[model samples]
Target chain A: MTDQRDDKEFAAFLAGESELADRYQALGSEQPPVELDEHILAAARDAAKVHRLEFGPPGGWLKPVALAATVLLSFSLVMKIGVDSPVRYEQVVTVSKESDSTLEGQSEPVFYEQLARSLPQRTLEMKNMREEQQSEQVIEEVTVTGRSRSIELKDAPMAVSILGSAEQSIDQDAALLIVAEYVAMLKTKSDSGRFRLQEMERSNESTAKEPALTASSPVASKKDWESIDKLQTEDDSESMLREIVRLYTSGSNNEAGTRLDEFLAHYPDHPVSVKLRRRGY
Target chain B: MLPGMANRPDDKVLMVRYRDGEVQAFEVLYARHKGPLYRYFLRRGLGTEPAAELAQEVWMKIIRTKDRYEPSAKFTTYMYRLAHNCLIDLSRRSAYKITQQVIGDDIDVAGLPATATANPEAEAIYNESVEQFRSALANLPDEQREAFILKQESGLSLADIAHVTGVSTETAKSRLRYAFSKLRQQLIRNRDKA
Candidate 1:
């Protein structure tokens, strides 16, 4: 019961203050040394410099240039690998089977030989045929090692005729012919890969001559599409700003100013900028 | 002390001037707050030297963070908060423990020259009461002690105390209440003994 009373008494005593509070006030009223003022002010100045160092330079142009380079390089690589490699060109071809009555027995082999060479070139020309006639034209015959298939060519008035003799087989499927032509083109292009490789080597040599241009150009850095996994994570802006400020206040004003200008341009309404403006930067 | 300087520009404006290479504005700010800040550390069991050192440190922190200053709060609030943190930091570094011995701790009350033989009995009573009060204040929790100091010495409102200590007004009030209760109990005990 007395402990409870003491708790109440304690509360009341604290509420009912004494002159000790006044005495404490008097003790604290003593004047501080004059040097203290200078010390603190100097500290504040140094702190201001630190703040300036942490938040000084804006990096406006550098970011966009970096982003543009990244985007352009990425897009160029993707196009180079994905969408551009399989393009097809078509042309129409007129086929005529030679009647070799003198070499009747050997005529089949000669016909097959000529057919193999002419078939691919003929297919190449077929794709260049006008779109209106594309559907009607077809491969009337296809022979692989004497096993032959004959397909009926649609005889529409617009159809481009592909004539062949009775001994030869013709497959007149338009879609199959188109695909075959595309495959043949791919083969031809692949066969000439060494020449293209030589051309690439020459371009690379020329590129090395103008290093600055190569470095600046977006197209020069195009890598394989799969290598995009190597892209760096974005840097932390606050730390970057700190570094920029440090650079600025440490007598690199021009570099710092450029970075600061860049940052302000990028983030016009940033709180850091407000602080910078207030600091008379 | 100059006329119309009572409604002076805020710290932010002064800081901006300072940033513009005007050192005088910084001096003015230093002059205005240095005494109070020094007193703040002194009252919190720090010696004159330590108080001055901490005051300098607080000001230095202010300078370092000047470029990041937002005038969302009063300059005094910001400065005192810095001082408070610096004191806490110093205490941690020095491992300084403040004892609650009142008159016997640093000064010898019995050794002081007698001011009045006429009221020796009353003087003894007063001294005892003051000692109990100091003991109770020392016994309070750190938060309560801080709240009481901020209120009693800094003359900050409960709201202002909350802002300085990063507590809500209700928490500040609660701490004050606890502090008051503890001190009141000690005072009453001294009165009972008398």
Candidate 2:
């Protein structure tokens, strides 16, 4: 209780209600050494200067941006030196020897050969079309055909159309002569294989050679047809012989029988005719 | 600290100037408060070297954190609070129990006995009793001594003291009352004996 009373009196003394407050206040706080004050104040001034540099309008943004750019440049250099670049253009050219057609009847080996032979002409037509579109300083034109990815960059602009706009057709007369010769050689293999002593009377066979060989006969030139019909090779004769045998095997007996007679008249001494005779062709 | 010195900028105004990119303003503020801050740590019984280092650290913190300064409280309250926290951090770092041992623990605190003889050469024993009074002040408990020193040094009100010390206003008042009761008794007894 006495302590509580003394507490009030002293509180009053601290509040300057008594003369004792002056004497207490007269007991002054100690002073720090002059060196210490200078050191601390110098630090404060330096810090204030740093703050101004960091947040002052232009300097603030510029330092950070330059720092960021430098960091990005460093990272880019590290990546360039340390990591290997991959080979970007890897090419595997696969020649497809197998036929893709699904047709089941009447599509003979000769027909497929003809289709394969037309491929170069078809590519020439597409190249012609690309040339027609641009006449500039064409640095390079590389066309990869037959379904393989190639390792060429199309550095120049090209309008490459792979569809049916290309009208690349072989001469109709040569195509027909090829078919006709094939038919005759095939007939010789199946017919009685001796030279027919009588010539194929041209007057008798004139009707058989009428507009010729399809629902839509080829629009071939007369001179071209004459030239192609007059030309022949032994390998072509063998292939043609195979084609005639196919015709007979397919049961076109009347046509095959007459064509056999014509083939014997044309190539009477073809050595394989003797074999046909033995087979009672 | 004087009420009549209104012509001079207050601590808060100088802090605002420093916050607004003025270095001279902070220098003015540091000059005003360095002595009181140094004495606050010195009286906590930290040796002169440690006390000087701690005081320097407190001012550094104020400078470093000037951008975050707000005028919600008096600058003296904020400054002493930083000082108080610096001392607490030092106490913990030193791993000393009874971290803040009041002012003279490092220097004047030689564990003097409760009696003393007056010097015959002195005209009055006022000077001698003052020293005794300081010893008695140092002998107060940590919180009570802190309250008395803050009141004497910073002249903060009870509410501001409470805010600075993270205590209630009533707790601050009670601490101040206890400290005053103790220090007053010691000083009065010493003066009577002299």
Candidate 3:
């Protein structure tokens, strides 16, 4: 489908073999004017000058100085931030502490009110402990007295028939009953003597001789007995009723009955006495 | 290649050296291509003044965009592509003016730079043939004329002509073939009339 003439012409064009090429070369001998050449060369030189200024030589100091300044600025910024952070944190902590103190001050009255409310309960606990201690002391005194009487009786001649062996044994039992009654009376003052009982049980063997030595002296026993008598006189009816209950729990019905009678005699019109009477004490 | 062109550095190297702030490299490059580039614009249907101006503009543009020039293609291809684009831009800006100029006149050989000829009579005949060739080139269609001009002015490969004119190699070859066939016909017709 191709024309041979067109192919020849295309081939000649590729080979640059046409007469038109030589003529075209002659036609293209025209050069740009000298003034135009001067203008362009001057422009190129000026451009190269501008390029040199913009992209300085590789050996120039400006780049190194710029890099150093950048590094120094970065280091300074980091150091400043690092130095300031702890102070800022401390300021925050101080503010928090101040706020906490203000809250503590605001809550002080509530704390005192709670303390005031707890005082009576604490006082009741102390009173119970003291009463239990007193009861124990009374038992110790009674035991010492029984033993001293036995010793006295032994030291006396056999002709002293007024305090024989049988009489001595009966007196010991009666003394035991008296000590139990006294313990029942003091026990009324306590809501709970469980802690005191535990302490006594632990210390009983170790401290058995200590109280005997202290209470064996007549003067010491009298002083302790006077304190017990004063406590009994000042004992309130409510605590006396509690003693009756404690004696009942201890399987000492006679002692409980005696204490109940004494409590009724002291406070006949008392509400606790009325309750006790209803309970058939 | 021109006389002593082989002795000098490559065009791409000269451009690279110029890009690195060497004025002498750019001067050498300007000297090497200025005439051909001016004639390229002239053969593309531009008057001498306009051709000179466009050639200057192309060089200035090359100077402006020196940093962007990559050595990926032949320097001739790159330069001609820029020249082609400038020509297209000028045509778009004043299509009527360029059309009138293209149709108005043929090249005046007297006004052209003198060649170092050994014989004056042979030179005169060659000059007449050159004038006829210029007329025939101007009469050719714009694409064919540009294809022919790139071929003559830059001595670029057919592929390079295709690259500069943004055409396929086959299309560039076809344009060049048609240009040569028409120019030969015009020259023969003009000679026969004379």
Best by TM-score: 3
* Pairwise lDDT winner, candidates 1 and 3: 3
Candidate 1 runs further than 4 Å off = A1-23, A41-281, B1-22, B91-135, B188-194
Candidate 3: where are CA atoms >4 Å away? A1-9, A58-281, B1-5, B100-127, B187-194
Off by over 4 Å in 2: A1-8, A16-28, A57-281, B1-4, B98-124
- How many residue-pair clashes does candidate 2 contain? 17
Tens-place lDDT digits, model 3, residues A1-281: 34787677667766877777777766647778899999999999999898889886444666897999999999999988765442210000012344446545222222222222232333343345444333332111112211111111111121112112212432222222333323322233223311134322233233221121122234223533443344444446535644554454445566766776787789866533443343344
TM-score of each: 0.39, 0.48, 0.50
Kindly give the stretch of ten consecutive residues in candidate 3 chain B with the minimal lDDT sum. B96-105
DockQ of each: 0.16, 0.27, 0.39
Q: Highest DockQ, which number?
A: 3
lDDT of each residue in B84-187, candidate 1, tens digit only: 78867777887876434321244323433343346988777555555555556656676787777776665567787888888898898788777766665565
TM-score of 3: 0.50
Residues B46-67 of candidate 2 have per-residue lDDT tens digits of 7667778888888888888888
State the TM-score of the second chain for every model.
0.67, 0.86, 0.83
True contacts kept of 3: 0.75
